[model samples]
Target: MTRGYTGEVSPGTPADVRELGTLTISKLSVGPMDNNAYLLRCRATGEQVLIDAANEAPRLLELAGDAGLAAVVTTHRHMDHWVALEEVVATTGARSLVHADDADGLPIPSESLVEGDRVRVGDCELEVIHIVGHTPGSIALVHRDDAGGTHLFTGDSLFPGGVGNTDQDPVRFASLINDVEQKIFDRLPDETWFYPGHGGDSTLGAERPALPDWRARGW
Candidate 1:
């Protein structure tokens, strides 16, 4: 159903929508950092879940429309990723979900999430994947459609060309790359399409060849 989802977004721009079989995904960029916020709505039940309330509470709420939101999943503890979290949660009264390791950083208390857990939007389910090293609690959501197409919402963990910034620490870089390679690259096929916290999107197959270069650069 995604006629032309280029995944290119910027602050103040309208969200781009992608309609999967059972679920609809809308990507919006907000804040000065251009942090992406995804709104997932279930076509069958009209239930909705927001991936991140990065900023622009009013705009995000507007994007949610009458259905509002069932929950907001913060990908990490980074400040930019949750600038509008308090406002969105306050306005919608939606449940807040964050990794246990980074829950303390949030403005409001949230349900602790971990690997193997699933977040539901009506009948659709998104599998949680805990990717460490980015912030000790960064997580990505995986949604596989009925047609076998896979979509990944990678926070600041995995990106187009390489893993997230590890602050130039070799150990952190190692941890991130290793977990990304094993937990993501090893398990998922090359056709997997990934959406990131900022900018455009890319497929695993397009980025697969650069795995060694990213690991070797130690970024």
Candidate 2:
């Protein structure tokens, strides 16, 4: 089940919540452009994990509460994804985790994560899968089972109706697309839910059918 909170203006801005089984994903709109940030919580243990601080640390902290944060995970080092990292970390005191390739670009550089690595929060585990199309170090997080379903936290790689832009290096974009097809699409069950960086949530089942068309359009 999913829930949404809109236009509840707070000093730090409030976020929308989507409950999936034992996990609750809080989607926050932060920064000047209202970049999306996520908070994943294990309902059973009350432990939480944040993804991409973006901006509005206070709001995120308020959302995280005293349940305490386990870690702050980033999909890449883009400024939009980490601009408010310092404030969040300072407020929550959570460790920051990112792909090793993009660790140098982090706001508060800390431990690095590699492909196939798993980060655990209470009884929940997120598998890190490198899907580097938007950036050399971009990645996606997959949770095998949560509330009787699978979930994916796709940073900037795969969106609801499209994929990340290929404006950087053509070769890199090609490689990213290939990785998504083989590593992500091929391996995961179609029922998986997708929590993208900047759009409404979708499922692997909802997205797979559109891949061929997206690929044909050279996205």
By lDDT, the best candidate is 1
Candidate 2 RMSD to the real structure = 2.7
Query: Residue 77: error of model 1 in Å?
Result: 0.4
Give the Cα lDDT of each candidate. Answer: 0.92, 0.81
Residue range with the least summed lDDT across 10 consecutive positions in model 2: 3-12
In the range 1-219, model 1's lDDT, one tens digit per residue, is: 688888998998999999988889999999789999999999999999999899888999999988989999999999899989999998888999999989998888899999989999999999999899888999989999886489899999998988999998888889899989988999898999899999899999999999999987888
Off by over 4 Å in 2: 2-13
Q: List the residue pairs that clash in candidate 1.
A: none
Q: Report lDDT (Cα) of residue 180, candidate 2.
A: 83
lDDT of 2 by residue, 1-219 (tens): 753433232224557676767777777777575577888898789899998887777777878888868899988888888988888888778999999999899868678999999988778889999887788789899987645588888888988887887785667667877888898889989888787777567777888888888777677
